[model samples]
Target: MDTKSLIIDTATKLFQQKGYIGVGLNEILKECNISKGSLYHHFPKGKEELLIACLQNLKQAITIDIEKIFEQYPTTQDAAIAMIEKIIKNLETEGTLTGYTFSSIVSEMALLSDAVRNACGELYQEIESIYFNKLTADGFSEESAYSIALMMTASIEGGIMLCLTQKTSEPLKTISKALPNLLNSNIHLVNA
Candidate 1:
């Protein structure tokens, strides 16, 4: 990969392992084997700029993955369950959820930086939008789809936190099972 991409990738991994505040630019420079000048050349605003790039990169990558799942599955309920199952599988194999560490960043640095906060918010909205599109396509009203997408996003993020803290996949597994029921109940409510 190119130097800029290398820096972003290394920084993203480090940021995932450690929160935004926990990581320093020097560490990212060392990790990327690039000098301070090179980093600044690529990121004139330094760490915050690099972080925004990382969030944008993650948003694109995750958007593609979610879209693929939604395309492969016939229904939003099936897609939702598959998404949770994929997380469970990743946690089982890797011992942590990768590419989905915005929670840590939000908690660590969001209050301190408007740029970071906005980037994270945009990424979250993108995720929720993907789910909302699928739900609406599957026949949910816009209101119901929006609510379900919000619930799904919150639940998945909360499930990841619980899984990480508890050091087990039980929370996500439980979420996988609960999501279908949640969808079904919502459908019933909408029909009624």
Candidate 2:
């Protein structure tokens, strides 16, 4: 990969492992084997700028993953369960969910930087929108789809945290099992 891509990738992993505030420029530079001069060349505003880039990269990568799951599954319920299962698998294999979500960054640096906050917010919205669109396509009203999307997004994020903290995929496994029932209940509510 190119220097800029390499820096972003290394920084992303570091940021995921250690929150935005927890990681230092020296750590990222050493990890990437790049100098401060090279980092600034790619990110003129330094850490914040690099962070925003990392968030954007994460957004793109995750968007593709979600979209692909939506394509492969026949229904939103299946897709949602699959998404949770994917996370569960990641946690099981990696022994952590750090690489899968950026909630740590949101908790640590969101309040400190508007640019960072906006980038994280946009990433979240993109993920929610994918779910929302799939629900609507599966016949949910816009309002219902929006609500379900929000719930699913929040639940999955919380599940990831639980899995990380509890060191078990049971929370996510429960989520995967619950999603179908949740989606079906919403369908009934909409029909009624």
Candidate 3:
């Protein structure tokens, strides 16, 4: 990778693992082995700029994969199931290379940067919207669909965290067998 991309990639990992405040420009510079001149040549706003770049890149990168996840399944429940699979596959494939998600970013830096907070919220809303639409398309009442959408999103996020922390995709594996349970008509309760 070139110097500019190198800085972004390095910072993305550091920021994900440690948080914006946890990682500093000096550490990034030392790790990249690049002068401040080089760093500023690429990012005039310095670390904040690099972080924004990382978040922007993050927005662009995750959207495509998520859309693909939805496309792989023929129905809403199936799509949710496939999404869980994709999450597991992603964690396994990257092997910690991708590090964390926008969910983690908001947890870390939401109150720190307005820009990061907005990006993280938008990223999550995008995923939720897709699931919401898919659930509606699958014959669910709109209100019930929306609730299920949120529930599944939260469930998947929790599943991912559990797996990431435990260093085992067993949560995904454990949940995989129960996916068919979602297809039942009365399985989900919604206040309507």
Candidate 4:
């Protein structure tokens, strides 16, 4: 990797694992096996710059991949199931608590960094939009679709945090089983 990319990637991993404040430039340099000059060359603004880069990288990756996930599935039900299943599989293989990096970054840095917060907020909006589009296409009314999508997105994220905190995947697994019902409720709301 190039110097800048390497530093950015290194900082991302560190921040994900250690939180934004928990990591410093020297630690990132040591982990990347680079000198301070090299680190400064890539991120002249220092830790703040690296943190911004990391947030941007993650948000971009999420926006593309999640939209693809929503597009590939034929129905909202399928997409929700797939989303939950994918996370379960990730948990099984990557360790249950290992992949909450983005959430960790949100918890630690969202309040302190406006840029990071805005970028991450955009990703959250994208996620909600994906769900809303899928639900609306699947027979939900506009308002109901948006509400369901927003609720489900929040619930899924909360499920992940609960699963991580409890050191078990059951929270997510149980929630996955009810995703179809949660989705169906929105359609019913439209009917009523």
Candidate 5:
């Protein structure tokens, strides 16, 4: 990777391994093996800027993955479950106690930086939108889809939080199994 990407990758790993408050600039510099001048050259606003960039990078990656899942699955329920299952599998593989990067960053920087807060908010909306669009495409009304999408987003995030705290993917697996039933129930109610 190039210098900027190298810096971003190192910072992202550190931030994910350690929360926003848990990591220090010196650690990032040492990990990246770059000088202060080089770091400042890529991220002038320093850690704050780097944090925002990392959030943006993660958000983009998530959006792409979610969009692909939605595109590949024929129904909202299938897509949602597949997405949740993928998360569970990933969490199982990584076995990290740190939880989701977005959650960690939001907990640490929500009140401190407007850019970070907005980026987080936008990321959430994008995630919710993925579900909203999928549900609507599956023939649910716009209002119903929007409401269900909100709940789905909340449930997935909550599952992630619980899984992280418990250090097990069982919570995610349970959530994943229930999502199909929940979406189907909502679809029936909306259509009925």
Candidate 6:
């Protein structure tokens, strides 16, 4: 890969493993095997700029995945379970159960630059919006869909954390198994 791509990819892994404040320019350079000049040339504003680029890339990647889920699954329940299953598979394969994008940066958002915080915030809202939009498209009332979507998003995020801490995807798999029941419960409440 090119120097810029290499830097972003390496930095992304380091950031996911170490968080925003934990990672350093030297480590990124060393891991990426690129000179300071090249790093600076690609990221003029340094780590902050690089992080924002990483967030943007993550947003694009998630948007595509979510779009595919919506296309492939005819029902919200199916889509939700599929999403959870994908997360389990990815966490197992990557061996890092931490939520890839904002989950890594969230703890340091208050201390980080506004650009970094905004990038994280926007990415989060985008994902939640995807869930909300999908639920509504599946014929849920706007208010009910909004509430259910929030629950779904929270469940997935929490599942990621549980999987990370437990070092197993069982928490995520349990979530996948429970989603159908969760949806049914919520749908009944909404209808009642």
lDDT of 5 by residue, 16-80 (tens): 77888999999999999999999999999899999888888888888898899999999998888
Give the whole-model CA lDDT for all candidates, comma-separated.
Answer: 0.90, 0.91, 0.75, 0.80, 0.86, 0.81
lDDT, residue 16, model 3: 77
Clashing pairs in 1: none
**In model 4, what are the clashing residue pairs, if there are any?**
none
Mark the regions of model 1 whose C-alpha exceeds 4 Å error after superposition: none
lDDT measured at residue 129 in model 6 versus the true structure, 0 to 100? 86
Better of 1 and 2 by lDDT: 2
lDDT accuracy of residue 102 in candidate 1: 74
lDDT of candidate 4 over 118-143, digit per residue (tens)? 87787778788888888888888888
**lDDT tens digits by residue: candidate 2, 42-140:** 999999999999999999998899999998998999888888888888888888875579998999988899999999999889999999999999999
Q: Which rank order by lDDT, best down to worst? A: 2, 1, 5, 6, 4, 3
Backbone atom clashes (below 3 Å) for every candidate: 0, 0, 0, 0, 0, 0
Backbone clash total for model 5 is 0
Worst 10 residues of 6 by lDDT: 97-106
Indicate the residue-level lDDT of 101 in model 4.
38
| Candidate 5 CA-lDDT value | 0.86
Query: Which tens-of-lDDT digit does each residue in 1-192 have in candidate 3?
Result: 899889988888888777788898999999899998999999998877788888877766776776777778888767767766776787788764254364566777788889778877776777778888877777777877777777766777677777777988888767765655755643454322
Candidate 3 TM-score, C-alpha based: 0.79
Model 3 misplaced stretches (Cα beyond 4 Å): 1-3, 90-100, 175-179, 183-192
Pairs of residues at least 3 apart in sequence or in different chains that clash in candidate 3: none
For model 1, residues 63-119, the per-residue Cα lDDT tens digits are 889889999998999998888888888989999887865798889878899988999
